[model samples]
Target chain A: MSGEASKAIEPKVLWGGGRSPFSISYGKIMMWIFLVSDALTFGGLLVGLGFARHAAVTKGFAWPSSEQVFTHFPFTHEHLPLLYVAFMTFILIISSVTMVLAVEAGHRMDKKKVAFWLALTVVGGAIFLGSQVWEWSTFIAGPDGDITTWADNATLKQNFFLPISTEGGHAILGMEGPQAYAMFFFFITGFHGFHVFTGVVFNFIILMNVLAGTYEKRGHYEMVEKVGLYWHFIDLVWVFVFTFYYLV
Target chain B: MERDDIIEYSLHSHHSAEEGVKLRKKIYFVTALLSVITIIEVLVGVFISRSANEGTGLWEAIKMGYIVLTLIKAGYIVLVFMHLGDERKYFKWMILVPYILFLLYLIFIALNEAIAVGEGMKL
Candidate 1:
């Protein structure tokens, strides 16, 4: 075929056989595709949760503010605020940083360095998963003591959510709409936590592969880079969950 | 056997201990930035909402502030941790623009629904 006619007949970047289009490997591109779709799933959950939150507030329900509801601390028995969850977020992000570092090391073909960073990433993910477990237990256990509920207006008169008991402890005097609030909170955060749980398991396998010199033999730690993408995606997801579920 | 030219070694600077150090520094900086943002958000939530009436402008502003800060953090994570910024502009926009547009549309519909739900409760 003539050059002009051949060019005219050929499709551009998207349809070009084996063309990466973005210089990313097919594997990385596929991972990106999956991540983008996963991101939409998270977006849908947050949007649905947002709608429920609005409905609860507008329907004259006393939607629990995340600040108060998640004030749970571990030992102090006093409201530790979002301290623990913030730490969890920090840990997740730090793990992400390590994952990226591992990928960078892999690019350099430094198997030892890759293993070092990947090991740290695994530790970070483990700690984050552990924090999730603690948070979930506290959430499921409910506030320590008796519980009282009032409508939104009645909330003004009784502000004590966790009344300190002279004997053991007073019940949580939450506003009336907590059941609905708890439902959304539990569902969305639970799903995110499940992802974190799976991510840690996934990272552990990658870590084992690294230790086994799998990537070293392959001449590059591209596997670490691919898993790093997933790790960072989890961390990115948590940023939204923290924003939508806790902050906003 | 023919060599695949596409599988060449990474063209970035050869591994230097300095590069490792620089990477560590960047990670620490990102961690610090994230921590600061989280602290400010927590402080805003605790102080403003606790002190002001929930319906007040200050409280509302703080709530809005949290969302904006969150978007900023999300953008930062995508750019840095996900290395999306390293991508070619075309690829970056192709992946990101649609998601942004979709999320904005979803937010718009959701807020409208919320307002409607609230209004209906007045009946």
Candidate 2:
């Protein structure tokens, strides 16, 4: 062995730093980078939401409880607090699980299993997207009530206690409200819903590729794995969105 | 290479029946765990409302709990579904540290600005 180490010359070989130093493939790492950037964007949205909400509360505006805002389920005349959102969240999470299974099957080179699981994942994502649309409609339509205006531009449009409400609860929110919470809610959640829709489309495309045996030709399921990364990120973001926008 | 092809049939089985069954079980376990946590989160919202309805303090406490629980779910998804749990420590930190720092900075800045705005509005 040489007594002294060789001079640290410029890398001329594989370690020239063009390749991933990490154990993972470059594509997966790229996805991680994208996700990190996406996470920051979401962080900004949520922080902005926090600022607006805090200002609303400090200004003595009534911010409606999440339970009140998300109580409705399609075709259900009952007041089920957070029922619809809980269902939406569950459906999204289930889709994530299916995505995980699809990726796993890809790793196993099980084309039939991969296609089956990816199809299910696509369905789950579509259902969640559809649910988001329904929830958005319900939100925009708002509770059945009359607008009672106050000084400045604050308004509280509240419907009588919804039947599914555990206690007599009035659903209160509007543009003129002290906080205008509805605006922030619509913007942030709509942005997230758009993401979910895109994810659904992405999953559908990946599913088609799986069924076509594209990865089978390559003898690797890395494409399925890559798309799984994306689907999982969508699920992750929704957790934060759910917390900040609804439960919090 | 007999032919140039876009896709070809797989000639190998990558997983055995037993392994497939085990993986299916794991998938079911994760789904059940996630669903149960969601249900608990919902039930907490519904049942705890009685006390939370009594006071703002109680309501805030419940919200804090909600945040903690959501973070748990988020972490679990990353660890299991994203398979980050099994990654090297350095890799985990590389991915997680930036997000943690960003969220903390956001919370600090937003809350501070909110307080400042509140004071400014107190004309």
lDDT of 2 at A210: 77
Q: Going through the candidates in order, what is chain B's TM-score?
A: 0.79, 0.71
lDDT of 2 by residue, B1-123 (tens): 666432121222245567767767876887787788788878987666632473578777777787888888888888878877645455678999988987898899899999788667632
Q: Kindly list the per-residue Cα lDDT of model 2 for residues A63-156, writing each as its tens digit.
A: 5677765667788667777888888888889889888888777767789988998899888988987887877666555452122222222223
TM-score of 1: 0.82
True contacts kept of 1: 0.41
DockQ of 2: 0.33
Residue pairs in steric clash, candidate 1?
A: A146-A171
Candidates, DockQ: 0.33, 0.33
Off by over 4 Å in 2: A1-19, A142-179, B1-24, B50-56
